[model samples]
Target chain A: MKKLKLTIAVTGLNNTDNPGPGIPVIRGIRESQEIESRIIGLAYENLEPGIYMPLMIDKTYMIPYPSSGTDAYMERIEEINQKDPIDLIIPNLDAELYTFMKAEPRLRELGIKTFLPTMEQFEERHKANLVAYGKKYDIKVPKSSTITSHNDIRKIKNDFDYPVLVKGKFYDAYIAYNEDQVTNHYNKISAKWGLPIIIQEFVKGTEVNVVALGDGLGNTIAAVPMRKLFITDKGKAWSGITLNDEEMIRITNDLIAETKWRGGMELEMIKTNKNDYYMIEINPRIPAWVYLAVGAGQNIPEALVKLAMGEHVAPYHDYQVGKMFIRYSMDMLGDIQEFEQLSIFGEIEQSQLHYPNTQKI
Target chain B: MKLKKNIAVSENGFLFDPNSGESYSLNKTGQLIVKLISEGKSEAEIIENIMEKYDVESNALQRYLDDFIMMLQQMNLLQKEED
Candidate 1:
């Protein structure tokens, strides 16, 4: 088969202490033997390591933060489209997805394609609504509450035991051993990520995450489950090993078919000591650990791109289990001039800069 | 004051502490500090070297170095003073 040539754009390139999925997603895309792709990086911050890896990203443009509103966001993308006429965009950030999903219609009209969950599918699966979502889907989920006020913190003692999880609407989670810890986390998380903090029952179990892709028509194209071997203080997976769990695959397929979900999603689950799996949280897009899935013999990002381009894709049946992904950060050296170019002009082409190959150290 | 004896560091900043069975990656600056510490350089000497090369102030370098050493201790990468 002749390799299909494509120009693809991706976001969520922040590979800092709290890494994003862009580099891993790009790695997955690049690993596709059937597809030859020119990658464009959409970065929100100037210092995102993906912007400096000229070998991986042919071009990079700084997009406005999601808080800039969808209009400004769309305008920047529109200008980029005029220059490059993007074939498809895979937005990897949780915060920027609302804008991209809302702009789907206009984007399609402009000949830009994206595979994403419907707004309804996206919202219903939010952490704030996870309890109802699990109920509707007939999945076991930990009891949780979404409270906007500190007064509600006291009421948690009535239903939940000590050591509940205090979580922000979008990010950050802390285990509070008592009411004071709950209140502390509530204040800290709410201040950083905004109101309506989520208080969830702490499920005692091993944490497992599944990275899956859906065809948007009740079909799961790919699913890979992994267990974190080592975790950083920030709760990021520093090292993880893939698992060959039939139950995990079954749950993923069931959830995808039930939701008729589209695009990439990460299911954060807890497998209790008794072996019952409880759904913890759902991230709407591909996770930062997506490269692990790719290495496990499922090129999910490639399949997702094909689905977005309206190509018929067969669901993957088997993958190598026990593949381990150990994430190790390395400094990507870049010239001050490159940072200046990206920050000042909001765009730069790799061909314009004569940079040496990006090394791991 | 010193990196653990079994710590193996690569040129590209990959650090493996055989004692903890954990691996870590550092930036260029972090790699330099770890390397210097392993070579028996004092905190003050490390600060002076970084300040001379990185165009940073002495106070800021000292503070960041202090924090870095604290993290190294937390990760069990630093050796005990008696060891």
Candidate 2:
């Protein structure tokens, strides 16, 4: 008899071997003899199997516009399905969330399972929607306003502080100056994204990501919030440390519970001087540091699969603390023109000593 | 290098990852799987147990569970338990 293989349809996987922010960790999972799975990168192409082959996938989905535009990259999922049906489709990235949401009914019909949120639920948690969710959840998100038109940007320049955050339709967020600057930037963004403008307060402080798994029934499986030390201009988590912030965990869980969520999530939050966590963007997908969670003894991927299998997962207490994760490369250019565009901190070249990457961590 | 595991056995999902200071919360099925791994259950036996409970397909479960555990070992959470 042929052994059964549980297939995971991975969306947003680009064909490459470079250690990217996502996917490699999934590969690591396969390499460790922990899980059995195949991958679909961007609708076409499969990485040939090798040491990395167990973790490498050659399939993808192209839905869910980024702060930019929807890439239609997910159209390939259908092609891969024609060969062998996927058991579960993990919308492993923010870009694929909308794609998964749209494909939810079809996926269910095909017997593929996924913990997908509704479009409204997804939109409601978006950064621009943060102000509204904050109002409802009582979480302190920065002061933000929606931009339905170019004139909205003009109104914002006079109203709010400069060096403000300009959010895209997807997850990529950047900062801009006064109205003209915002308009120019928005024009470029809208041209590429076809998304409405999201002008928000530029928050300052140590940024952190609270990675958690939630039951659709309002219970939490695990939560690991991290404080970031470095970032790309695009606002990806570059270097960070995992800390046990009861306050942060409580507030983030409170918000998730209120929303009645059922899936894995990663949220970007800024711990201000007042020690308040001002809510920023929320990514509904699992984070790139999912391997970090696995390292910490909380394997969300394993937990998530069990839940999907309808097995009762035991809820374990979080007793670990003060673990740090650092990503290092000689390319740490402290002085770059692009750094200021995405950074809240000014010119100060921090040491390579303080940084750590789990690969090098 | 090949992967090894030294997971503790009990009803509670108490995983103390000595490599990373992060503790874990595991569900019942997760507990059983970890126990099986600690007891040195082969991949085939684990799959048989999984099939007994889950109404879902096995091939997919095997792939996911295989990759999932491998990830644990790569992260150093799974190591050979010294008898």
Candidate 3:
């Protein structure tokens, strides 16, 4: 069998305690038998550990944050593409998806392909619009209201109970037992992620998550449900196990069919003792724990690349049940020159370190 | 009273339910009851096996066995009649 050789660029390389999806996604792509992948790591910070990992990234380039606006972001991408000619780019961060989606057309013109949700799909799943989205799609969701100011925090008591969830637009969620706690979390989260903060009805249940990929024409390419076995202080899954939940899969498939959702998505849901599943949040991109889906059976990043290139890919039907993933941290030693190179030159080729004869990018 | 066909109870008292992908560590008595249940022992047989090995009275052992079976049912480690 002939392998497709493609150069793919991916973002969200920060593999810290609160990891990103980049390294694991890269691992999935590298393990593909159908494609021979050349990975280019796109990092927003100089210290993103994926840049320094040996034999993983072909080259690493520092990119401007999405908050710097589209022009700066695209210009940096264009410069990187000029050197490496990225066939496809996968933007993994939730905060960066909007910028990438907005620049999709320009990226297409630059001969780079991306499989991402359309602007309508993205907007409909925003944290602030989840209630309306649930109603529109006929999915059960916790009652939530978006508030822009501190004064609106007082009104929360009238709408929700004492133990409500105080959440930010992009990230950060706190279970506030009283109005004072709501005000405190609101200030902290708003100051970081900005308003309007969302006040959501807290539901008591076991949290379950599903990571799935969909073709724009309403086909589910892959879906894997998992229950977190252990959680970190940051609320990220420290360990998790794959589950056999037919209802969760049905909900995912129906939602994809109804929305014609494109690209990878993570559904955060709460399953109550009464066996009701309530939609909590929908992340618009592949999650950090995507490798668990790959480990179980479905290689989502590999399939996603195929879909982006307009290949006719079939949906995966089965994955190994009882598969578990436990995350751990390891420290690697690197010379100061490697850090200095990326910090000063904005790019570093890992191959250039070992194979001095290799051409520098 | 049958344990799920796929449920695995290791000798070290670790119980794994493949259907739910949930595992639990059982104490010695819990392990003994689950082992007997997996062997297709009836409720009365489980009580007899426990009373023979342990120093507890039959009535007290019966109550503990009932409670243990309920826990197993709640955890979905026991196979339903349909299965």
Candidate 4:
């Protein structure tokens, strides 16, 4: 069979200690037998490791941060698309997804397709709105409330007990043992991620996660549940294995069917001792551990591209149950010239030597 | 009565359950009991073998074996009787 050839642009290239999904997602796309992709990496910072990782990115272009607003963000994407003609764009960062979702129509005008949740689907699943989302969707979730000021911290005890979770709008979650600790966390997280910090009841249980993709028509293209075997101090999974949890899969399917979520998402849930699964957070993009799903047999990145192209994608029925992924970091030597090119010009292209003769795009 | 067909038990007492992708480390006694179970030994036969090898009373060994088997079952390492 002739593979579908595509020029794909992807963001979230920050593969660090707290990694992004870009590199892993790219790896999945590269491994697809049915898709031939020329991967163009979109990076916010020059030091994003995916930009310099040998053959992973055919070209790297530094783009404005999403905080610069949709106009500036789309301007850079427009420039990149004009040069390379991106067939599909997979924005992989939580911070950048809203910008891309807002630009979906503009991107469509330029013939660049993206599979992302609608504005309503994206807004409903936010960390600050998770409790309401769970209630509306008929899923169990820990009791949580949003607080915008320091005054709300003292009032938390009236609702929730001590040792609650203080979470930021986008990232950073700290377990606050008392009101004073909540105040400290509130000040810290608000300074970084801004106002409306979420305070959630701390449920004691095993943390399990599922990386899934949903078609706009309510079909689950792929779903893989995993348990973290080892976690970093920042609460990122360093090593994880796929699981055989029917409950996790069912919940993922139900949520996708109800919301008709249109892109890649990660479901962070806590499995209690009583076997009740509580929805803790919903990340509206592919997760850093997504390559594990690909290894387990559901190449979600590839499927996502197919969906974005408006092609028919069959749902994945099973994955190898025991597949595991252990992340490791190694230093790679790079010339000053390469760094200077990307830093000064904001774009760098790999030479043809990086690609195999048969695989060069 | 039996370990999962795809379960792997290494000589160093490392046990791997392929069905759930969970692994466990066992002590000498734990490894011996699992090995005997894999060899299709019955509960009484397992206890008799352990009593002869270790300085343990029959009743005490029986109780320990029962507990160990239960743990294995809970971990999903042992195959169901129907299977």
lDDT of every predicted structure (CA atoms): 0.88, 0.62, 0.90, 0.89
Fnat by candidate, in order? 0.00, 0.06, 0.56, 0.50
> Model 3 Cα RMSD, Å?
2.8
Alpha-carbon RMSD to native, per candidate:
14.2, 20.1, 2.8, 3.2
Worst 10 residues of 2 chain A by lDDT: A345-354
Per-candidate TM-score, first chain only? Answer: 0.97, 0.77, 0.97, 0.97
Which prediction has the highest lDDT against the true structure? 3
Q: Among these predicted structures, which one has the highest DockQ?
A: 3
Candidate 2 residue runs with Cα over 4 Å from true position: A1-5, A15-35, A39-55, A58-76, A328-361, B1-83
Clashing pairs in 3: none
Task: Give the Å error, residue A288, model 4.
Answer: 1.1
Model 4 lDDT tens row, A10-120: 888898999999999999999998899999999999889888786688899999988988898889889988888999999888888878888888999999999999999
lDDT tens string, model 2, B1-83? 22243334346787754322245787877777777767668888888987888885888988877886876765556543451
**Please, what are the lDDT tens digits per residue for candidate 2 over residues A135-171?**
8878888998878787677666676888888877664
Candidate 2, residue B23: Cα displacement in angstroms equals 21
After superposition, the stretches of candidate 1 with alpha carbons farther than 4 Å from their true spots are A353-361, B1-83
lDDT of 4 by residue, B1-83 (tens): 99988888999999887545579999999999999999999998898888889999888888888899999888768888888
Return the lDDT, model 2, position A256. 68
Best by TM-score: 3
